[model samples]
Target: MTGFLAAVLAATVGAQAPGDGADQRRRLVEQKIRLVDILINSPAARGAAEGHEADARALIEQGHQAVDDARKALADGRFDEAAKLADDALRSVSSAARRMSSGEGALSESAQRKNLQDLGDQVGMYRSSIEELAKDPQKGTGAKALLRRVDGLTAESKQLAEAGRLGEAGKKMAEAYKTAVEELSRLRAGQEVLLSLKFDTPADEYAYEKKRFASNEIMVDMMIAEGRAAGDKRRLVDGFVEEGRRLGTQAEEQAKTGQHAEAVKLMEQASAQLVRALQSMGVPVF
Candidate 1:
């Protein structure tokens, strides 16, 4: 009886170890899901989806659904199921990434030029929007500084494009676009200019909040990938990302409980945390 009891105690101790197999497996699966999420939401994947690439869209959707199911399985203590789903999600997203890469590689020089032109046009539109906001007395005072930054970025992007550095030009334009959007959002907060959309319902507002949160998530991934969040900054950025994710989860919970207003507010806060994280990494998001 003594020996049997000792064996049982040993087994219990093993099960409760800091590096227990089950806990390790759960962590690994969670990491994979995060990686899959980043890949699916990457610029390449997004470009393909925007271009109406059916395969890319379908694969991205499948990966997202798998990730959702994996999270549910994890919550229910179905570790094996969660692991399988996470693996499946990673595979789907990887395939989509490959497809997007191939499509981009197939683009002709002229096509690339056209893409750059489109980005420039987008920057122009953002500049116009900011200029219009500058005409508003209530918002104009704060818009002046942001407008100057956007103008500088826009000019740099144009120079990059003219120099045949299309890729760099695209990045510059994206930065300018992000700055413009963030400035507009800041200036128009608490007004009908919520991202330039007047929500007809709380649901619409919630949807917009979710979109913004997802965009911020992508920016976080980009910063990490670009190695901007390294050394001591990595830990700080990670803290902000974790906080943002926590708030985003809370926002979803609130939305599910029909507290749409609270949900939108929480989500906005979540996105703000992510923006702060990006800034901490020296990203020129604004």
Candidate 2:
């Protein structure tokens, strides 16, 4: 049952643990399933069942090709690009799901049974993927709430599929997937912000980075802002540049090592240091 869901998951989720290519393979499967769904929804699908079957087969083939492209991207460390390929495959699948929700391919009871079973399988696959993700120390990547959210949605989808209600199940699944993707994007952005703080000479903490070269204090006044990783107070002059760059490097290293949140925190510190140094020099960092 989990055969196809695994593939779609690969595309939707962030990069896997360095060694687990299995996750990538599974996402490819999801793409293939989606391609089948697309062909089934095509205009030619309903009029001639034979034509629909052939087209479905072709879509499946195309989906596999897309998965391959995504897998290569993943292995190459192009996480953002890999994510995009996965998105394309997922979109293909979603398109088919939308058609199904609209009752495009109203099938006989026997066919519906086969289809529901496939959906059930997909649900199972998603559940497994979620479980695997749970093992990662990071609870949530961006929104810091993805794994829990996805798990709840996966469970609901499984129940809907089991009840032989593919349309409702698909809709719920779609929402869940969308949420996960949104969170992933957030996580990426947050990682970019980790450990870095910027100050402009012309601005206080409340007026940070207002314009291209706005000035701010070297140390963060707000608890929401990142503070120095070590020590307290601001640099008297441009003397803090070394400390700031050190923090930035640490943040980048952490991000590269998959401690995305930690990396950002370190980076913010570094940025703040640079801000003070630039201000002392009477230069703009923007």
Candidate 3:
């Protein structure tokens, strides 16, 4: 893409509305574009849009390592080492953005803009997701608050996306994912909470302990108790089917990582979960 288009794109990103609605705008961007669309539509900017993002991932991976080291440095009071590592990671973000916006880069301006927009939307999705999760009764009120960090990131993502700076946006996404995982790791899982979540149904509990298949008695009883419950069998079946798909995907990931034994165990668990999720709604799961 031409310099004029790139400038215009950056300006548009700068004008993005900040707040919850920004996330909805981001989701729209994802539904609208792809990486290959960059190469095909804007040959001049393709490298900046696509190739630089891969480079950014490598940088972010290095940043993760540095952050790990930085933690140790902080604990040991090695301030210099911790500072250096943090600076390195921050520089990676800046460097990646610069490369993505290089005028001589091959990605077309349109492709770069679309790629950035998609990243912004994902960041927004994470931000809004965390906000909504906070309101869920099933979620822990004790979960560590990372909303402020995520908000900063959503803003960065929006800025980068509008600039058609996919490479930087990709790196930001890596950081966002890392922060989210860290936030989850910080959650304190209390014994009381664990016990509260446990199933109290005697028969189901007994069956679980024996590693035996679940009997349909409880489900049937519940259906009978709630007069119109059977009417929603199709919806219930759909939930099972969707959950089964997730378990299968996770199983595939485990296998790919060379944990074949664990993978088999997970796959078996997934199968059981799938069967439990799918049985009796009209499609037989046996």
Note the Cα lDDT for every prediction shown: 0.69, 0.44, 0.43
Candidate achieving the largest TM-score: 1
The TM-scores of all predictions, comma-separated, are 0.52, 0.27, 0.28
lDDT of 1 by residue, 106-139 (tens): 2344544555565555556567767878888888
lDDT of 1: 0.69
Deviation (Å) of 72 in candidate 3: 47
Candidate 3 TM-score to native: 0.28
The Cα RMSD in angstroms, rounded to one decimal, for candidate 1 relative to the true structure is 12.1
Q: Is candidate 2 or candidate 3 better by lDDT?
A: 2
Off by over 4 Å in 3: 1-106, 136-144, 163-166, 185-286
Instruction: State the lDDT of candidate 2 residue by residue for 167-226, as single tens digits.
Output: 556546644544443344344443432223444532232222211111122111110022
Best by lDDT: 1
Model 1 TM-score?
Answer: 0.52
User: Model 3 residue 15 lDDT?
Assistant: 33
- Which regions in candidate 1 have their CA more than 4 angstroms from the true location? 1-20, 41-47, 104-169, 175-219, 230-268, 282-286
